[model samples]
Target: DQQVKQNSPSLSVQEGRISILNCDYTNSMFDYFLWYKKYPAEGPTFLISISSIKDKNEDGRFTVFLNKSAKHLSLHIVPSQPGDSAVYFCAASAPHTGNQFYFGTGTSLTVIP
Candidate 1:
């Protein structure tokens, strides 16, 4: 079973529009959720995170919403820019795992100019 899944392997959006990426998880034990943005040949950088206790968290142009009841999460970027074109990975970990995370394969977002 895939504990974490990003159904869409890629997404396309025009610059200045909103971009939304979705993810799903099967494990309820995952208490900490994170979104990471990765550029080519580089490691993922942490974007936003939310604990199981919270439903939504936002940082600047990025926002993450967690729906615990449905075991789903999404990352939203408003006014998407060409610079935002990259792979986004959703990751989760339990506090007991020492922050070791399980990652989704990834979603490549292409922002058109």
Candidate 2:
């Protein structure tokens, strides 16, 4: 199910301008979406990647967009989630003390792979 969707089918941005990508999701569980991927892959990559710019425009000048604008690429999105209700905890203890440990509160986690 494509719970999360994009606003536009296709968009074109200028060389030096802001590109605001709008993403909408039908499910309320998704609180945020990761925008602007970090780095480019070796080859045949899928996703928009923009690096930090000197001007600090925050759009990062759309590095991947500028480089690969000539070629058409497909973007694949697959959201992952936990199957059952499980609590994940992280505990810490001294080097030699096995019994003396501290545990964090149980938190339900959904993994997006």
RMSD of 2: 18.2
Stretches off by above 4 angstroms in model 2 are 36-113
Q: Summarize candidate 1's per-residue lDDT along 55-107 as a digit string, tens digits.
A: 99999999999999999999999989999999999999986768578899999
Q: Would you list the C-alpha lDDT of every candidate in the order shown?
A: 0.94, 0.29
How big is the positional error of residue 87 in model 2, measured in Å on the Cα after superposition? 36
Output the worst ten-in-a-row residue range by lDDT, candidate 2.
64-73
lDDT per residue for candidate 2 within 1-113, as digits (tens), equals 54434435433333233333343334332222223222223222123422212111122232221112221112222221222112222222333444543323223333322
Task: Give the local distance difference test score of model 1.
Answer: 0.94
TM of each candidate vs. truth: 0.95, 0.32
In TM-score terms, candidate 2 sits at: 0.32
